[model samples]
Target chain A: MVHSIDQYVDVVGAPVVEQLRRLGERLKDIRVVHVNSTREGGGVAEILYWMVPLMNDLGLKASWEVIHGDEGFFGVTKSIHNGLQGYPVQLKKKDWDHYEEINLKNREHLLPVLEEADIVVIHDPQPAALLQMIPNRRGIWIWRAHIDVSRPHHQVWKSLKQYVQDYDASIFSLTSFAQILPHEQFIIAPSIDPLSEKNMPLNKRYVNEIAKAYNLDRSRPLIVQISRFDRFKDPLGVIEAYRITRKVIPIQLVLAGGGATDDPEGKEILDEVYKAAGDDPDIHVLLLPPDAHRQINALQRLADIVIQKSIREGFGLTVTEGLWKGKPVIGGDVGGIRLQVISHYTGYLVNSPEGAAHRIRYLLHHRAKMREMGKTAKEFARENFLLTRQIREYLTLYLYLLKDRGRSVFV
Target chain B: MDMDTVPFYIKDCTLLIKMSGFSPAFDIRDLRERIAQCSPSVIYHHYFENLLAPTFDYPDFRNDFAVWVKRQLDDDVLAERLGMIEPYRFDSLEDLRTHTLDIIDERLSELHFITAVPPGHEFYFQEAITVVFETGHVMNNPGEMFKIMPQLTSSSIYYHFLEARRRTPDLTDDFSLWLENFGSEWEPLIRDLRSIDFIFYSLPELKEELLYIMQQYEVKE
Candidate 1:
């Protein structure tokens, strides 16, 4: 269990503070439960680790629970994840049996909690199957899909639909991600905490200390991309971009992040990145512990440039975090990344390492343009990517649900 | 508190205000049963016309429902607010357990046992069950609170999500498949909403004139 700390509280800002105070006054002692896969690694888990406690602090009884899944279950779920990301990977029928078996196992154990809570929220694909097996469960179940599903592969979509259809409702980060479900759907975009160590303004001393501790040169202009070392993240492509940009201006690159429990290919991708970075002194590949939030914050602050360059992305929280810290990020032009990295304004959305390298070179040479881009990027996040706005939408959604509950039927 | 009394109907105007902005005390439940009583579904029949069926069909659904709901608040300036407010305070989890005990102690000290359910009202709830006594009839309700699951208000994210599903989808399936699908999968939720010992009491259909409004829109099943 990740420690529920107040690390991300300040970025929630004054608007959320005022709104939550009012929300708490209206909602005293209301019980809320959030269930998602993994306590570390993924953005959903990271957000909830902070959000659940903050919700509780705002005068609601809120708690977080991590769902259990084994290697085979993850292997199956990863396929579904890939499939949802528009990848076609066929699996056997027993793969599904394993998925449901884990879900049923969890359902048997989670019955009491599910039955008792005022609201039982299930996150993502791994635990979504738990809904079908909920016997005598009473509370509302909302499926919070943090993925960008504008172009999901069909078979995986078809396979997951069985478990998904059982939910009271499903929420997508963007309107394009929603599918045909037998429940109410809402378009609630994901958010990053402006005050978290990953996004907050850190002291120059702290940034330098982390740099010194990691043997990173403070004088050298640093270009960093913080993301899990996964194939789709295109970490290798980022290395190529860094290498290309280094031909003219010798800059340091940091590719840092850890593997999610559900993502099996992360470690292999990490090893592959190391080979590409072999004997390159400027390239620093760090497999960071999941708790290294402040480390990332400092890196983004110190870095002259940041890049995502993922082939497929759900709303990239790292992109939001980088932009929030006033750094111009060049991210892949796909999925939720498109919502954040508005090409030329917030950051460049590139199709290739060549494209990414070209932007990096120009940004490095032109600090004034980079600074202007960073300001726009941070302002964009403040206007859109903050948690308070997401929470307000949720509160409004809740009110809509309650009022619609006992309304007279049209027919 | 006559059941038939139209307490606070706004005959001409419509108000879609938030509870926090308007009445801070009311739970802002769409279903009168949800916030009104512990077993508000006791008046399961009350929610039949009020809660079931497609919401998209009723353009005046929120306004019509608000007429009934606005009265359930006691914000003084607003509608009727039910549920006792004078309970113990447990501001946070650090003191929640201890505060719960204080509430228990206070309840013991101020014990006044009066039945919340009225005499013979059990028969009314009992009759409410048989409207969907057959499996076939219940499928028509789809994502409505009574048919979807127990304990969801229309305003809850869960309820809206279900509402989204109820909205028209360009489904690739046939009518035969949808009909043969008795949706026995949702039986438990329906069973929970309608009392287990529910009697077959049908609610009075109030908006027969507005019923045709639903045919204009095609909501997915």
Candidate 2:
């Protein structure tokens, strides 16, 4: 479903919505194009699903474009993705060539729209090579790196840096993820759509039905961690935490996620997670389809305590989603999780499975503190991690780049 | 009191923070060196622009340096000393930087070993690009503030009230400066605005404080 800026007025107040409209007016009719690898699945696609429509609603001419690739191309890009996340993967020259060749193939179809646009934002490494490909572009080009590339593999970063260095600007989700690029690098954290099926409020009946279908016992407390089955997400660690917690308290664990087309490593990780779960009835390792948003939403709503537990993360939108559903998140103390989960406030940040298990037990034992933290978590997500604030920052960046680069204040 | 014809053009701002290209500091000595070498904008952002950034609404300390000291280094005494340095009281950001380094130096002198955090907890230097724009809401008179106070976004509150201290010539809030044109009858409200200990309050808390003051004055009017 398409969303308008006005729909968010009830979630965020009228003043916030009105502020977006005013910012929108300043850049009315400016053509903005966003290019990424996949049109569905993953956080990038989910963000674009709401962002493009809302930008149009706010008066900017915005569009989203996706680059299609075969499995071999995706495999190569996945290696680059893993390597950028500090995983040791050697991407050869042929791998880099195949990556660019696929982008070059898509360049023919995308060049016209990309060249004439007022601003073109290339998301992640898949389409990052497109910048150097479109040499005659007449607009400000920005590369938005959504992953943690702070301690990337040297070979992969050196190759990727060449593709991104000439852009007018770059954007990272966190300051730590930024590299020593020659151009200006801005920090814009990703946010979730509160009105989307994934985060929108569901009726109690529907939530209960989802719970019943999943065979989750209503009597026992549930701990849900929803993320892609990647080693960085550490599904095995979540199970370990659950096992440790179950020894002290009876709780159910749901490790649910869907696969994206661009992520080639998910299947192997999923198999590993299933083996680690090992005949445990309470541990539900679900490989959900791409469109199972409401089911994910229901699972989060059913959770007494939400766990991300990612060893490495890119803003951890699942944590935001859980917090939006009024469940406190126990996230790993790495990457963007540190930004969202505050100890003794929203949720605790843990370094190990033992720490996570300890916090899970503590939260379950102290129901009142859990309720209070859940309340604070929801309001915290409302104030900081919603889509409106993200859009406002994007618009602000556009205004800053287009109008004046040196001025402290735009007006 | 006569109403001033000059309308207050209410504006709002959002900050787009970026890396200052400085290396992350893992220890107090490294932090002090970075503070001395980093640009003034970096100092200004950590000290002043932190309120508008995405963070906990009610942080224990007011600034990022102190928060890092308190949370990562686990040193309450140094955190308190660094937290007590008011950025607004300093004549310039350079002076603020100097005072910050002095506090760090004093703490370093007291410690037998350098206080260092673990790998992931290192302090990354950052700065922001603040984009300010007209909200298109104009206040015609001082009495209208009673109605407009609650409706203001936190960014609008920051732009007009807190950020105004640095921008205006007299180092006063935009509200107080605008109300000054209406004569001495609004002095009580101006005094009330001035009386706010803004250093400790977050944007939302500051907004609530402003709203409470406006509500009290509105009743009197």
User: Candidate 1 overall Cα lDDT vs. reference?
Assistant: 0.60
Clashes of each: 46, 0
- Output the lDDT of residue A38, model 1: 94
For all the predictions, what are the DockQ values? 0.01, 0.71
Error of 2 at A217 (Å): 0.8
lDDT of 2 by residue, A160-192 (tens): 999999999999998888989999989999999
> Pairing residues by index, what is the TM-score of model 1?
0.63
**Poorest stretch of ten by lDDT in candidate 2 chain B:** B1-10
Top candidate, metric TM-score: 2
Candidate 1 residue lDDT tens string, A272-305? 9999999988899998888888898888887888
Question: lDDT of all predictions, in order shown?
Answer: 0.60, 0.91
Judge candidate 2 at residue A277 and give its lDDT. Answer: 98
